[model samples]
Target: MIIKRVIRSQNRVIVEGKNLVKKHIKQGPGHEGGIFTVEAPFHASIVQVLDPVTGKPCKIGVKYLEDGTKVRVSRGIGASGSIIPRPEILKMRATPRPTVAGPKDTPNESCAGEDTRS
Candidate 1:
């Protein structure tokens, strides 16, 4: 199963096509009420990362390269010891950063009128 999201605080994950549940919604303002099928969160301990080389579930181990770059590798039983690359979703930001500063940001220039020596 593909992991859709990881909730660190709750130690749970949302996997695709797993732990499916039905949710009942009540009618409200600008909202429709009905039963909806949704994916429920499950403990991360139950899931294992699949090794790319062996295509089997295996325990993950951290390894550092000669250049001091850290990476995850498959270990333990049925392990291939292959480096696991980070998913593309993990590299993407939920909200993009603004290039221009907003009103809340302080001006880059220093206060010229303020006295320096006190």
Candidate 2:
């Protein structure tokens, strides 16, 4: 009796594993004289799948055909707008502006200390 196995991929995104494994083998003697196997799957639900079209994580749906084959489909984005690093922007712009005295006039005594420090 032959027992067929159905194994789901563990990667969040589908990847060319054997080609990558071959590249790794050629790069170094590590895992020498042995075939590198892909990592085993955890629960499929635990992974967040990314859409290849748009660079974002998307909801996945599996559809079964009448011939008993499963096709994975990716649903599009949830919220629209790109994520911004607000704190980083604030930090970069947080520098204090220098107080401008008259063109010929010297800066105040407070700024005299600053000039000495530099």
Off by over 4 Å in 1: 62-71, 86-118
lDDT of 2 by residue, 3-117 (tens): 1222435433323331132223444455455455553323435545455556567676666668986566666456223322223433564466667766777657756546554
Local distance difference test scores for all models: 0.91, 0.47
Error of 2 at 86 (Å): 36
Report the Cα lDDT for residue 73, model 1.
91
TM-score of 1: 0.59
Q: Write the per-residue lDDT of candidate 1 for residues 37-89, one digit (tens) a residue.
A: 99999998999889999898999899999999999999998798999998898
Worst 10 residues of 2 by lDDT: 14-23
Clashing pairs in 1: none
Over 4 Å off in model 2, which ranges?
1-47, 65-68, 76-118
lDDT of 1: 0.91
Model 1, 3: alpha-carbon shift in Å? 2.2
TM-score winner: 1
RMSD score of candidate 2 (Å): 19.2
